[model samples]
Target: MLHLKDGLSFKPGLSDLGALASHYTVVFLLLTHTCGGQSDPQPMVAMAGDDVILPCHLETAADASDMTVAWTRPDLSPKFVHVRRDRMDFLINQNPLYQGRTSVFNSKLKRGDLSVKLYRVKLSDGGTYSCFIPDLDKESTVQLVVGQWILRSLDLFNAAF
Candidate 1:
């Protein structure tokens, strides 16, 4: 069983699968802070054929020019979407689908910008992404909402309100 900070617990294997399948998870944030990490809580919305920037930054605004920044989607195999190390892209392990479709603004790295731009968004791209700064021992997440799901989400939101 995995236990969360608020005392919520669940066994993560077989039994949990069906329960998860029956649920519609709206949004969730998990911040593993060893050194303060920050990310915009509002998801970045984009159409299926649009380019989008998933934003993340350090709460302390420390220089990240030479640090290792890893972007990954926990639910994907060979999860790496992008990885920057020593001020250059280290793409040897990037997922094939993301090849030639992601980039970081080198000019902004020095100011603690760890965001990545993803091009030609697809419906499969809708999910939570994890940003890890190994040097700072911090991690944060951002969500990408694609296409028609955005409209359905808004409808659900207004109904609840």
Candidate 2:
């Protein structure tokens, strides 16, 4: 038994699955739209001079150390942030800003862990980063909010002063 406002009600049964699903579909769309469609629960945050891991995963048991993993920032000119290929780091087209500050887990790549670690994070590092596996056509994104906590701390200090 399901009840809705405006005196509407339903006695859902096997035959009424279609109707129930239709109502659920409408509700799902409404909720998502109302939430502004931003599905990421929370953006990753890191302070200046800290290390942060921008997580990406393949969710497979296959070995991927030999596969090419492309980590890029779409807003950057060169775009390619860190790329691994042929069992070695390929930096031919990597962005200069990330030249010596990024790396992956060598031991975990066999399990499809494509996450990258950013060393000594800077405020300029705050942005959307993406990881893509071309051969598998799989990709994921991580939003980094760098130094936000520092900003909040400054705000508190100013208020106290």
Candidate 3:
């Protein structure tokens, strides 16, 4: 004999299953009513010259060695400030203005790394730099900020006085 225990819920018998199924159907229908959809997350945010890392992910297993990866200051004429091609040490097409500076931290391409390092970052470098991964047809950008204040105070005055 099946006994109904106190505070314990039991599955309804086949005869009551129709009612149970209808109850579930009603709940599912209620939840399916949409309110709205979500927006895509912004790709990049700015940081001071403390070295900002632009995040990018690979979508393909194809060779990125011959892919044309470009990083540009988008505010201007889409100037090709930096172009990386092949796995042999990314070539800095060197904007006449960016001379004596700008190096890449790009490591092994097979492992899918495409990071660039800007050295002694200046105020003019405070803009968006986009890295285009053609193999995946994806672009990731990072904003750079330059600050005037030094993090540490000098001890020159104590030595002199």
- Winner by lDDT: 1
Per-residue accuracy of model 1 over 1-161 as CA lDDT, tens digit each: 64554576656577655544444343322222222343324433446777888777888677899999999998988999999998789999998989999999888887888888989887777777888989988787776656632234433432332
TM-score of each: 0.66, 0.66, 0.51
Off by over 4 Å in 3: 1-55, 59-63, 88-93, 150-161
**Deviation from native of the Cα of residue 36 in model 1, angstroms:** 6.1
Least well predicted 10-residue stretch by lDDT in candidate 1 = 26-35
Error of 2 at 92 (Å): 1.3
Give the range where candidate 3 is weakest over 10 consecutive residues by summed lDDT.
27-36
Error of 1 at 155 (Å): 27
Candidate 3 on 1-161: residue-level lDDT in tens?
22243444465578666644443322110001101111233433333344444433344434455565666667755365566766454444556555545544454445455555555555566666666767666776655544443322223312221
What's the lDDT for residue 52 in model 1?
81
lDDT of 3 at 25: 26
lDDT accuracy of residue 119 in candidate 2: 92
Q: Which is the winner by lDDT between candidate 1 and candidate 2?
A: 1
Backbone clashes, candidate 1: 0
Candidate 2 lDDT over residue span 1-161, tens digit each: 65544466666578667644433322100000001123554533446777877777776567898899999999998999899999899988999999999999999999878888889887788777888889888777776766533123333322332
Reference-based lDDT, residue 99, model 2: 90
